[model samples]
Target: MSMPRSIGSGPAPRHGSIARSSFSASYLSQSPIAQESIARDLAEYSDDEIEQPESDSEESGSEDESDASTVRPNAPQHSMASSYRRPSFVAFGGTRPAITPHGAEGTFLTKKEKKQARDEERSLLRDNHLAPPKHPEPSRRNTLSRIYKKVFSTKTPKTESDLEDPPEALFSAEPSESSTLLSNGPPESKRSRREREDREWEAAVASGKIKTTWQREAKTLMTNASPLVITFVLQYSLTVASIFTVGHLGTLELGAVSLASMTANISGYAIYQGLATSLDTLCAQAYGSGRKHLVGLQFQRMVYFLWALTIPIGIFWLLAEKILELIVPERESARLAGLYLRILLLGAPGYSAFEAGKRFMQAQGLFSSCTYVLLIAAPLNAFMNWLFVWQFKWGFVGAPIAVAITDTLLPILLFLYVRFVDGRQCWNGFTKKAFRNWGPMIRLALPGLLMVEAEFLAFEILTLASSYISTTHLAAQSVLGTVTALTFQIPFPISIAASTRVANLIGATLSGAAKTSAKVAFIVACGVGLFNVALLFFLRSYIPRLFTTDPEVIRLVSTVLPICAAFQLFDALAANCNGLLRGLGYQEFGGWVNLFCYYVVAMPISLGTAFGLGWQLEGLWTGPAIALGLVAAAEGWFLTTANWEKAVEDARERNSNG
Candidate 1:
């Protein structure tokens, strides 16, 4: 005759929710293991120090002390003769074991009694007649110190010296008998989302440079300069072929080729470079962190993923004439530009894929592949241009066909090389994990894409704006633009190398090295820009002859060459700033910088100066010069002022849980 457990005042249903049944059975044994353990621990404590068990439970959850005290538990000894009754700590009737409880004064609180005491304490606090207690609030300084000790105490590896001793040793390769992964996670995956976050946070906490430098800034500048040199060579080659072949066909064919080449390279530069370079950032970081598998997976996914993005680009290629008609108002120029753009576009996706694959290799410190790939394709592109235009008598259309074939071929060749050569050689480094996760790809690409679009739009608008000027002015603008494009490659490669190094040093938490690298890159770019300025001034006459020999066009172009010469310093600053920002995952900031430079300040002032100030075409180009120069100086100084240690500390704080 034990009293049954109560379920409210109503009769209980035979069948109910599964949870209700479990609850009914669980209430029978209220002395859970946690409660028992607490009781056992309290056995060693003095009677006055032992806390009430119910109060401990309530405090754990923090909101139910009153409810806990209302429990009408059936006593263990009084069970033989019991009746359902209102709860009272002191019993009135029944069992002899309940007659005299002698040791009760020892003060070991039962769960129910402790809960009652807690409820009384709270009630007293709420009582209107009782005065409020005066207590000082917890200071953040003390709390933070405790937290710091907890995080960075004996277990925290603070210095290179601290890491010498191993902490709570982990199995070298997991337990052999029942081996858990000796690796971090899935065999294909090198680093989990959580793992990367944790390590980055830890590195940041150490106040280490995520990007560092020393003598390498000069190297970074040299690296950036190579492409500029190459660009100049390519422009020379293009001009030689166009004049040699299409020059005999009259101004229409010559102009057509001009429109086509301009459209093709401009599109290729942005679309292909944007996607491919973003991959380089990812691959570089992965390489730095020793995530061998991610490099390959990233490469593979990019190949397939690029195919998707290429569809729209491909469509533009296919419909180049239609697009030209819409964008270009002069009917003849529009038709000619459209025809050339369409042919060039046929080879868009292939060229784009080539760019992406090459960037992956570049990130691995394999820039030679780019040179090798260029060796096979660039000369072939030139030869094909001559053959199709002069050798086959296809005219302007032949140049586009030639570009298309070569553009597609380069990517195919690179993809094959990566698959057969790098594929088997570095299986571990080419993990399939990156292909599986879309997160990294998206994070890297979005910002770069924004930059590419903004930059491309700015130039396209310039072209449109230039069209508003006289024909001679338009020609000068184009000549200056083309020269700048060709020569700017000098600093680009250095920027590329700096980007990879910054990412690597940043990841390693080598703050000093990262700073050195940025400075080195800046100094190198400045030197290269200075040399380029002097060289352009000395060879001003020969430079215009490279594109065309039309006396008037050449004269206007020569006049503007000096203006182009003046912007190299600005180019160095802006390009390297872009590198620094991209390396430090400040892509969004770069985008904002571009927005301000291109639209907010530069475009309006330059446009106003060109048209409003009666400066005309030369004045329009001057707009971006001033804007880019100012932005470069500001961004470079900002990079200088940044607290690398604090940045790392913030990153580490975010990643502690992992």
Candidate 2:
């Protein structure tokens, strides 16, 4: 191993030359150190260099070795500090290195010692990776890590090596373990991104600023994927079927039902989503903190909380007409929406329950069952809606009632299924104790509720405003909104699947897998979006006549159908992006992104162009096309932008404090 050096004298061989983030090649190209950069960069970022100095571990030294490697012709002495034991992949269940950190056989830790060493490494890795150790393999190592972590939780410095580098001196940094994790090269784009992350880690650790652990990197298995899949299946199956069945009524009625339902759903979803998101924070964080049992209690409490809130929700449903009137008092188109809301209230509790059920499964990482349950509930919801609205000729009023029946019964059925058909470890025991302990549960869900509240208030205002444009425009808005709803359903699976997988991986601290899951979700969502757009385009005109018989309404919607078809792909992107953000505990990002997209960009573009420019309903779509497209792109980028190692680090710091 090479010795430590001062910050600016020259790049050391062991730690390498620090490239200032502010260093421009324009200036650095003229410098003496610039000529020696290859050696510095190689030493700094050697992908094969997994070894740390032996003397640095057991024997203390002022300057571990001679700081005279390549880079410095003068070999000016500069110092750096390198403490916290670097973790190896073996700690995370990858192949164990036959040789130790020093590359010696004699001083190498014994099997127990090796396990202990790896355990500490795993803790650090998992702390950044976001997964818990699974099975008989690393349990012993993890336990020792736990004990060691408890006692020596803080970084301990035995040797002073390349630690005091300037923050910017890492720009020239290169590949990370992730680069090697790929046998073949990743795309240039990905390899560059990975290098940036490694430099970030280097800068953070070198600067003594704690690196953030990635949330999804903790456990990418099935955590996020499960929740999203479950939510998507349930919401999409029921929603699409309802739209189709109602659309068959004719354009006017079709649009009205679709419009009102869309409005109602966003509103209701805002509420449930707000509450459920809090459950995610609570459950994931709690699970991270080793409070697994508390998650069950929180799930139960969320149920009651959602139920208690339902009374007011029901009252609001009762005043659906008044609400609609107040929302769009002058618009005749709003009349149908008002009627629909009054009827839809009967199912508020059911809506709340279904959401709670998801949180329950999500808490325990048993999110796979949600898709199964959705399959059951979605079909039932459609059948009931079809039977009452079309077969029975009840009109838009029947649409709401049928939906209520479906929502109300869904929770009860899901609960039975959870208990009987496919049992869970967390849900296996039903107890009074669980009911009595609601403290943590309430804490977990509160943040999510707050977020939902902010989002709902914003959309509610927009929905109300859209009703005034024109009867035709309103109907158009209805159809387009339903299309948006239907298309959005695709990403829920991707998001939930990510949440469950990422959360478990985070808990287990398996980073590489967590990152891969994020990739899987993004790819899957895009593929689904592509498919949805094709199907929607194919079924456009034929689909609209189901709700209303008005040829004009149908004609208007058909003209716009192609636009929706083009936009559906963006819709998928936005939904999936939001899902990915939620999995990463980045709801705040969603809140801000939505605020900008809906209010600043989307609202202005859609409403302004439609109402002000006389494009009316088409204007609404135009705005969404631009705004939603931007949002989808942003979200997709964010999902792909995740640095799982950082996520693991952040989770560990957060968990340790908690």
Tell me each candidate's TM-score: 0.57, 0.57
CA error at residue 493 for candidate 2, angstroms: 3.0
- Residue-level lDDT of model 1, residues 1-658, one tens digit each, is 0000011110010000000000000012121222332233334346764333233232344222222222222121111001111110110000001000000001012233334333322222222112122232246558788886555432212345323522112112122334344465444222232232233333332432122124334444454445534532442343344444553444345444544544553454444444444453454333323333444555666766777777776676667777766765556766876777777667767755665565456444344454555556656767887789878879777866876787678777766676766533223343334345554465555544544444445554565566566444544555565556545545544554565455434433445656777777777778878887887777778776765556766786677777777877777667667656655545346556656776787678868987899777677778777877877877777787877765444323322211
lDDT of 1 at 210: 24
- Runs in model 2 deviating more than 4 A are 1-234, 250-252, 255-269, 281-300, 329-339, 422-444, 457-462, 495-540, 546-548, 572-591, 632-658
- The alpha-carbon deviation from the true structure for residue 65 of candidate 1, after best TM-score superposition, in angstroms, is 60
Candidate 2 local Cα displacement, residue 59, angstroms = 39
Question: What is the C-alpha local distance difference test score of each model?
Answer: 0.47, 0.46
lDDT, candidate 2, 1-658, per-residue tens: 0001101111111111110101000111111221132123224433553222223211332111221111111111110011111110001000101011110000111112223322333343223322222322344567788786556443222223324432224332334454443547654453334334434434433444332233333233244244443444354455556666666565455545644654553455445644554454343333322334444545666677778877777676666666666655453445676677777777777767666666555433343455565567667777887788777888667767877787777677767777787534444244454344444445544544554344334434444455575555555555555555445444533543444344433423445544565666666667878888887788888766654466776787787778777876776666556645544545356546755776688777777787789776667667657766888777667666767566655544433322
Q: What TM-score should be assigned to candidate 1? A: 0.57
